[model samples]
Target: MQSSTKTPTAGGRAAPAPWALVSVLAANMLVDALEVSANLVALPAVGAGLGLPVPQLQWIVSGFAAGFGGLLLLGGRLVEHLGRRRVYLAALLVFAAASLAGALTDSAALLTATRVVKGFCVALTAPTGLAIITSAVPEGPARRRAVSLYSFFGAAGFCSGLLLAGLLTAAGWRWTLAFPAPVALLLLAAGARLVPRDAPGTRAPRGPGWHATAGGLGLTGAVLLLVYGLSHLAGPGREPARAAAAFAGAVPLGALFVAAERRSPRPLVPPVLLRHAPLLRSALGAAALNGSYVGFLLVATLHLAGSGRSPWQTALAFLPAAAPLALSALHSARIAVRLGPARAVAAGAVLAPLGYALYPRAPGADPGPAGLLPATACVGAAFVLAFTALHLQATGSVPAGLQAAAGGLYQTFVQVGAALTAAPVAALYTVGRGPALWLVTAVGAAGACVALGGLAHRGRPRARARP
Candidate 1:
């Protein structure tokens, strides 16, 4: 788990240039992010082209999430067991293939399947990329800066996806789908050249055998059901009975997973990590922030559209929220290093609630771009301050061997937060924009408290154990 003096590479080849390595990995991160936002804007066009109903069309977005969120834990375990570089490269190739398939597919189900495949591939690549960074880069300012760059690219990719969708969907939704394939291919070629080789000693310990496999499958199934159930709960046509059934199913599967892991010599998730305060707090804080931001976005988008603004105008207006993100993220590492990740997160957390509170709350209120500027700017700034810090807190202290597993667990929290929050926020928006914004503000406030709570009794020394 210790930091290596030199970047790890296969067959004793020279380490890739740091810039090249980070850029390639960050680029892949961008591709994963683009999958989420680009399809969002293209959804209506996709439905029209495929003659799909509104309810089915929603799957295009939710399905990707299901795949991404469901298998994240298993993906993390795979990265550890299979080799980070190997898993990352293989997943990238599959992601590119899926993107190509998605672009060409005429059938709605097939397109959705392609999306799920791409998402699953992303689940593999994301944690591996982070694991690579944690292992290749030395800890301290260098690792912090590398993580900042990685986080920045993810933010930039989402924003770019929105703008790209606006342009590509003009030609056809297919163009939007096809664009990522070439970009992913370019990244794949670069990754093959740049990603460091994994050391042989890094694989999971021998002897868990079927216990490890069963635990992993059970955990994956449980998460899959949870995400799908949550989606059903929040989808346009809320299927409460089905959602309840899925939740009920997840309980036993999850219990079985716990049992299997307890018996396994090497559990998929190390039992100690379950008690890791930093990881748990970071996951909770990230979840709260992600959920609130996504909820806010949903409310803001609907509010803009209802006020008679064009889609392009609404997208452009939201630029204030996404444009400054990369810049802020670039500086987050420095901030976290200085103030500590916990305090930095708290600082960022405060801005979001303030932004939400400042916004006009009335259902009839038309907050044009000018009126909405404060809220968007605040939320954007919040991400800049907290996002990287949260990442730092979550994985920074984890042992090198468990980096991917830790990253997966943290990211699962984030994805679940975004997915679960968006649905309820949408359902609430139907009740009233005021209530929806209030809910977002409340979530943000709670997140801020969680972050601040981490700072309690700062610098207090732990009591010594008896000799």
Candidate 2:
């Protein structure tokens, strides 16, 4: 669990170069970004090769989403106990292994299971990488720029998958599934070099015993169910009663997670961070924005391509929305600074919903580039504007030591929102696009309300100036 090299920061020595940490974290994040989007282009190939049914194909994402969402907190905790370097290498090895398994498998069950296990491994390392960046760099303009670039790169990496999807998918699903292995291998190598060892300090690290493990298992179960419901509900005219059951089962299980976390000594989620007003808003806000954004996307995608457009054409038509996420992530910092973290959350909550509301009018009846382009841009911009806003604000005040945990908690909600929204709103489209779009509009607008509610607390006269 100990790091291999001596970390200068631990001894009041000069810290590692900011870029070093950023580079390392970027690689860490890049693979995660790839994992989320890479599978999209291969879905058709996967179905054909494996004799998979369309509805059951949800496992490509839902399985991973369920797994990733379930284990995030435990991932953060593993970092705390294991240290970033050890956990990062260990997880990436597992990640690469799982990716390889996904590549070679023709069995639907096996492939889906590999993706799920890969998600679990990714869950372990993803948060830890960001935490390492935060810990390596001092909080200031340097850390701000570093974090922004890292996040921006992550956002950019998502779009990069789209560009590469063409080449990789054309080559075959095996190529797409297996491609991430080299990236993971590179990160694992860099991890060995750039990462410093943590020498034993006076304080002993806690062993991640039964309670922590059990709490994580429970949380993972609940989130998996939550994502399953979301994706299942959204699939094309899928089974209604079954999806409803998934949603219903997930709800109480989620409650049980809250209960378990409270009871555990070494809780997967720390209580203070969980209950923080601004932080909670950010976590939930990321979830909302992604859910609405991705769901609307899924609907728009199906409508455009389902109407007989080529796969490449469908990807091209959606370009406007896809382009802005990386572009706007750069400005995320300015938004954070000008508005301060809390107000930024409020801003995202506000803009994102309004953007969703405009969806019906977007791309117009003609489906011309002018119409679709503007809408895609608006929605894409909304995510960066809001997501960055939330990220900056959410982690604004956490103690240096808890940075990893905060990241884990933040992403936990991110995937949960995605998982929860994917199918439900898509299912709503059955009533019509008019109804489905409105459903997303409503969901996004609700996040804006939550953000503003934080503002309400801000205005209540400061609690009589604390006497």
Candidate 3:
């Protein structure tokens, strides 16, 4: 792989500083991560401001996941065809515009539309950013370090967003909605100046054949249906029949998608990619990590709300959990070298469930931050260890050309896992917080087992680089 340190200049002058490229990409990641959690804290305020019911308000969150997860494969394909730098800049422009529109609009429908648009833009930008990093940074230690830094920035971004949400919501929920616009605009400007242009002589891929087109359509439909059904599973005015129908519809579409991909000349997801055990393991680990974390967040938020904690207090309560994320992510490259990636991931997998288990053991109602500290710390540690390790594993396993696709696939698993687990956990929360916490524990344990098993098989040959 080429070193990310230097790119050819327009007039054969010196390359832009490496720090400039890193800053632009990391800032882009921060903006994306901020969107995931910032609005979460402001949900109640937004609902009150827009006179929206809880069911409708929840869509503001789910709509983003649906658009992000559903179109990820297509986004990856676009990155390949349209060029990474081109897609990245275009997506940032759309994201900035959407953030402004979302803040200005009073209509809930318009706000939701903006969320979906931003989500779609994120689908393009996130993976492409990763691809750009992989393309610029050579494989081995430097790339590992770059990936670690990238993951650290993402974790820090999520933490920052949670804190920002509370501060912004105090002024007005719209402030939280509008915050990303300026950040995105700044990143876009910086990115245009610093980000490397596409390699010379690179051209767009040919149009997809009929089978590839069919498979892509089917896969997109399946993902949308699946996410929509899962999001509504525990929602107010829940419709079991609709959820069931949506899920049932998805199965056949998914089956057809697989069949069509097998026959396509230019498949969206190549069959060989499925056989890559390391990538698959990393993807599963990522899914489990994200799903359980989001589930915990949902239950914890509900518990805090029930305890009559203010939004600010609730955000503050999560501060302890976010602290370890950056520390762990930054040092994960060294940890992976010492313990091996699979073992490090396994350790994190075990730690997360242990943390979730603590939640159920807390004495009485309103356990407070003091009671929550141990569990929150463990959860944060798990994110620090697992996310950085899994990111390195997945991205390292893929070839240069397919880095964006791998990133999209990895991120799709993340969003889908969160959506899938959130529904059941949210449903269980209606019964009791204890049950939901236990469910998260059980899921985390399962993921730990998978990670441990992968560790035992670490002798498997690494994937060969593609031409």
TM-score to true structure, per model: 0.82, 0.83, 0.86
Residue 82 of model 2, lDDT score? 76
Candidate scoring better on TM-score of 2 and 3:
3
Off by over 4 Å in 1: 1-21, 43-61, 104-112, 133-148, 193-209, 231-236, 305-311, 357-361, 395-404, 429-436, 457-467
lDDT of 3 by residue, 103-198 (tens): 999998899778778888988887788778888767888777777667778878888888898899889999999999998989989989877889
Q: Could you tell which candidate, 1 or 3, scores higher by TM-score?
A: 3
- The number of the candidate with the highest TM-score is 3
Q: Which ten residues in a row have the lowest lDDT in candidate 2?
A: 458-467
What residue pairs are clashing in model 3? 3-136, 4-136
Model 2 CA lDDT for position 379: 72
Best candidate, lDDT: 3
How well does candidate 2 score on lDDT at residue 369?
68
Per-residue lDDT, model 2, residue 444, is: 84
Better of 2 and 3 by lDDT: 3
lDDT of 2 by residue, 1-467 (tens): 12224356645976456587577777678668767666764565676678765445556766776678777777666676777778888888888888898899878888878877888877877666776777776789877777777877787777776666656866777888898888888888888877666546612378666666777777767766655565456435566687689778867776777777777875777777756666787787787887777666656654554455544555566666666777777776786677665676676677766666665543334455655666676776666566777776677667666665677788888876766676566556554677678878877887778778766665553211110
Better of 1 and 2 by lDDT: 1
lDDT of 1 by residue, 79-140 (tens): 66777888888888888788889889888888878876777898888767876887877789
